[model samples]
Target: MNLTWRSSSILPRTSRFYQKSFRVVSTESRKESAQQEQEVTHDQQRDPVLSEEKKARAPFLKNLFLGRFDKDVLGFPELNKARQKNFNAAIAPALKSLMDAVDPRRTDAEGTVPDSVLKELKNQRILGGTVSEDYGGLGLNAMEQCLVAEFTGSDASVAGIVNASNNMVIQVLFPNSISAVNKYGSAEIKQKYLPRLASGQLTAAWCLTEETGGSDTTMLNARAAKTLDGKFFDVTGKKIWVINAEKADLFLVFVRIQDKDELHNPCDITSAILVEKSEAVALSPCPSAGLRGAGIQNITFNKAHVPVEHLLGDTLDGNEIAFETLANFRCASAAQVAATMRGLLTKTIRHCIDRMAFGQTVADFDMVREHLGKLAVWTYAVESMAYLTAGMTDSGEYPDTQMECAATKVFSSEKMWSCLSECLVLLGSKSCSPKEGYEQYLRDSYCHHHHGGANDILRLYIGLKGLEYAGKEMQALVKVMRHPYDNPSIYMKKNFRGLWESIRFNKDNIKLKMHLYGHIHPTLKHISLQPEAEILERLVLRFPVVIEHVLIEHGAYIPQRQMLLRRMADCIIYLHALTAVLARASRSYCIGLRHANVE
Candidate 1:
């Protein structure tokens, strides 16, 4: 008799696991939209990041990670009465009905979201949440949209659909439709696809990877040939790892465009073309260990013809649009991961409380409590980071959101992986069943590291971006030193400010105290936590020294030094997470939620 690892853990089903660990859970809504959005989304306020000139400048992470302690965004956000009502009316019921109805096991076995569920989700207006109502969509803002993704992350099949839908809603349809058409596409292209995408008449798949390239866009082998008429392009190539490949009506294919006149190694430019699935666009289901309900797939395009109007942007701008889309998609994916951890922690805590072991509840055990504590801390941190990133983008508060999103993605994705393992252990024998959610959770969580951008590539991106910012400052100092005699003012101004900062920077660090309102009630705006918050605050404020140390040593070539950069990037990721947890803890404290303490 062959026994698998999972089978070995199925301890006769008569143990404590049978009654407590297998319980399923259900999943919330809108703002009195504006008030709920008060923390970061003040429409009347202008964000400096919205300005292209200021956006070109890099932000000093010093506020959060040393030099100064910025308290403006350090606390959890408040959800007002209006926002609570808004959430209840628009989002809560729909998600509850959906989560309770779908069984991940069935979806996994079938490898597709059932048509009825998709239709219901469409009716709920979830797919169009990020699109503007003017464009015939629900037009929920980024934070709200990410909030839904968080809830959807609880179940495996639901998580996949939510993840896929989020990329399309936030990246493809919302931004690409507007940016590509208004900023880069011809008017003819804008009119052709934007409305259709907004209204959900045609769903889209973002296909960038191919046999020759995954992260290296330069190596992509797919090519497009322009016909003499200039009205259409004949495309030919294969693309892999396309989300929603089998279901989407339109394919956003990233390809190399070169004139048919050039024959040998002639691809010179990267571009995007929308292809319709047919015999020319052959899709095969690349079902994976997880996200099976999403129909994760690959496609082979055999000389598919795409309209000239379907081209996304100017050839030069295609890569730009793709990278921007990737950044936004990554942020959304991280938010979902946070939600997944939230759900896992919730159910595991419930299981521990209910399951009796050695004549006492599992929660009575010290090890069990410790695991739950870690999960809670991680969940809060990730939730804070994910939503804060969303708020920054939606509110236009952070111009350099790319690195923040990437860091959040890496941190949350990896943390969520650990979270799955912890939840499985706490669930005991119940987790060993194939039908139990943990098996699916483990499989699905693997994609977090690979999707949007692989953790490795994103880590390099974090290091590279940071180095660019560091270069500007270092160059300024160098310029002052080189011209000390020529411009005494330059030398004095640079050195004196530096000297002043050094004088103020004491070795005994104290948090810059400020009142923050993260909860709906303003009277108790300064809710405080214990030693954990203080530790996290200190760590966040000190970690910039680590970044500074590594940058001083490695400089611009940090991108090539992958291993060292990864360590630096991880440090950034964890520091950012700590800040997030601190902020989230404030919210939890104010709202009177359990485990608000990051113990």
Candidate 2:
């Protein structure tokens, strides 16, 4: 059987270049075709002049891979005073009250959140934090939502409950369902669903992960068949580890569209269907080591009837919808992890200050101080990155932030896990006691490492996404280099510039043309200059050269080289962290905020 797959969903608008179709006859051929299609798709998406304009207007970490850095783009984010104040005045107190009322230990032991707590959350509008006010939600922006996530995430189970509704469902549903905004859903569906969803009258579960397809949607077994009249779809599949499944009134399900002609073959096109609770849907609790109160379950849809109008996006655009939803979810996960780390660090610090060891407080020990310092720095960096990404999302300055969101998720989850381990070490065996709850925190952190997508997979995504941008920029140069005789003037001009630079600078020590010295605040600068600042500048300068070399050597096969991808991801993550830290600290110092120097 021949299989054909086409995706214009990667970009919002499909270019004429992507209209061409290809056929795949075998697995190997499919892989090669997909890669070729992806490269061409990327090339079409990034026109040279437009790419430069986008880089300047919406500079992100990917730009660093191509040796572009705009300090102003990395400037510290500022919150809207009105929104912050509104959140503080209305939301903060409710959150405190809810937190005081709910016991995470009890919730974990029972494997469920109490109805009273759920009701309280509904009343406080926490469940609909990101939904628009017209939909009976709090109308909070991305940063504000992160702030709320931070508060709820101090407790793992609570974070799970809240995020399942706010981060995963509402975030995905609202934009796709609102016709006035995205034109993906009918007005009837929006009016019928959004209000109930926002008011918490109806809860939602995102059902995308199947037993066969844990993270890779291509392996999904779920199938949806359109009825003869095309008024409704019959969906049949089982989704694993579905949060809020036990009580969800609505399900945002992903399934392949089974064509009549391809009855024996696996479907290639995926679609999202809004499935209302019905007798055909079955649910069973899925036991887990952590986040027990999140109401996770395995849901089997046996010919579930879904209206055609309930489709979230285009018929063959489930991949893009899923990717975009996961990206948003990852940004929220970063905030949750950051908050969890902050709470853990606070507890560990208090314990260290009070506990005695070797005739002195644990806090006084050099090793303990080192652990605490590292925790402090990691916490700060995670928080900085979380809000920075959140601000970018809210500001709408950046057109594509999937890479940034992935980096934030990877950095926060891994750092939080490490920090939790350190906290356990600092607190000793007592920390593992059930009553203390530190062990639970560690377990939840472990879950987070694999949640959304595994850190390793996200690392590869970051590397490949950045590499794609870099490769597009180098395509023209590579073409010229390959056939220099055909483009002699351009080749000679490029070589002459390179030769001039080589001749001007010593072979061993080349001067960097770009530096952050002028961009950073005066307080961070000194007569001799800070070593860290200088190191960042050097790394920034050297990064693009390294990317070019790797692209030249590996070419299109870089995706298969996991180790190299991991290393590239690490560098990007480090650079992003350093940039965020410096920008935030500089802003803090300039504003004369308390303990700015300490930060």
Candidate 3:
């Protein structure tokens, strides 16, 4: 008998020997072919990428402004660009020189910023940088002021001086007393004060927190009563923890104007101005654990005379202004924290790569890698959110930005502290010495964490906003549900159409499976199998199920139909990733295809 084993048709033979030999050959070839097909199929599955071509690419500016660019936005890119250019070209260079001149690398016995360095910082006009040029100052934007904070934060002393200077500039720029600007001068206030501030010629500090009063401005009791001349207020109070007071040319003191009962609002507070070097004043500097070079002070106003013109805003408006300024300044402080964290991480990563442990670099350790990965993820999330919020505020899309701002501030500042602490751990105690740059970061970060509104307070603010949004969401949801029957016909038609589309979309589901398989086959030859592809396939298969669950769970917060569709989209993308990774891995193994540098 004769047998043809390789034919497409099933072979049958009359002779037992031929039949047996044919069966053995056919079985072996079939197994080999199946294995080859599996290789091909897996490679195809992982071959396709998330196709960068389909990504929505646009400038962050356009994304931010959307359609109402010309009419609605208040922030000027031109203005910011100009200010940034000025900072980079003139201000940053000068400040860098000043920092270098002060020897940023030098640390005293206790990490104190040297007195000479502090003197130079005070002399540099750090206070005048944010005031507009017309206001007897350099007229920098809020963004530039933030950059100065970041620059100074590289060294604690400079950061302290810059903090004092920037806050003072903020106080002068936003006051309701532009008319009083020309009057309070020694011609010197404009000349010596303005030019000095503009040129980093003079620095200043703010005194707001009392021994008893913390975040509550209304609780302040420092008294400012009108003087005999009726043009001045005699301010008498002890203001504590005033930064840069040692060399500050001015002090912004918050005082109570309680006698004017009508001025008592929720935020009713008043500014009692005082000068540091004035003949009648007594300033006692405090020794603080962090910001040792910052020169915190206890100032006794002692009936010190502050010109009535120096009083900022309406007496009742002080609380409002204080809250606003603090909110605005919180963004800057958050930025500084982010920068310091970034720097610390950068330095630590470099150290890890270079330092040997267990006969290999620390970076090679799996545990260390995990920590670095977490640090990286945190940094990315915080940095992106903070920059986005800052851009929003600058562009004036921030009418209700308080919630977002507070959220970003609290999250990023707190994240930065955690990241820094981790970094210090990675560096080890010996490497974390003041001389080594680790301990100072830990110390300075404490101040950064507390500089803005406390995390706890911002959390409360966030909770309030969340509840308000949740209420609105629930009302809209209720309205939709109650009126569901009113549009029965329309709803029927829409549902019918959606069902038709879903049916049509899923009709070629096997083709989806085939296409996915094909895409992954080529990819499998080049790399090791990643679980991402498997997870994606499973997610896609479970897409409809996920939609149902989400509808049941989150229908109140998200519109039912839209949420279903979004889940479906997410599933498709995830499936796409799965197919791509599987294909790539198969292709890598089979044909030695080039593996991507995926990280």
Q: Write model 3 residue lDDT over 1-599, tens digit each, in one string.
A: 00011112222221221122112235658677456546543312211111111222222221111111111111111113223445667667767776656644554234456766655554554556555455555544444555666676567656656655564445454321111121322333444355556655556677788888787776787888886678978877787877777776667777886444655443334654545457666888676666766667788777887777666555655665556556556656655665666677789899899999788999999889888987876665554444444544443323334544565676677787889767767888756466785666666667766666676655545433333343343444334434568766655675676566566555533223312232333343234343443343334443433333343355556433443443333333223223322332332333332332331
- The best candidate in terms of TM-score: 2
Question: For model 3, what is the C-alpha lDDT against the true structure?
Answer: 0.52
Q: For model 2, how does the per-residue alpha-carbon lDDT over 1-599 read when each residue is reduced to its tens digit? A: 00000111221111111111111124457576556546553322221111122221444888999878756533455554445556767888888778878787888889988888888888787877667666777766666667777878867777776776776667665652111124345568767887887788888888988878977887889988889998998999999988878878999899988542335554467778889999999998799888888888999999998888887777666888777778777887888888888888989999999998789988999989999999999998998888777766655446577888888889999899889888889988888688898767867888888778888888998889888888888987766755779999998997787567546442434575666665556657773235566677778777887787687567768889999999999999989888778766765655566676787
Q: Model 1, range 510-599, lDDT digits (tens) per residue?
A: 543422222112322344444545555555545555555555455546566888767767777876776666555454444445553432
So what's the TM-score on candidate 3? 0.61
All models, RMSD in angstroms: 11.1, 13.3, 20.0
lDDT of each: 0.63, 0.73, 0.52
Q: TM per model?
A: 0.78, 0.85, 0.61
Specify the poorest-scoring 10-residue window by lDDT in model 1: 1-10
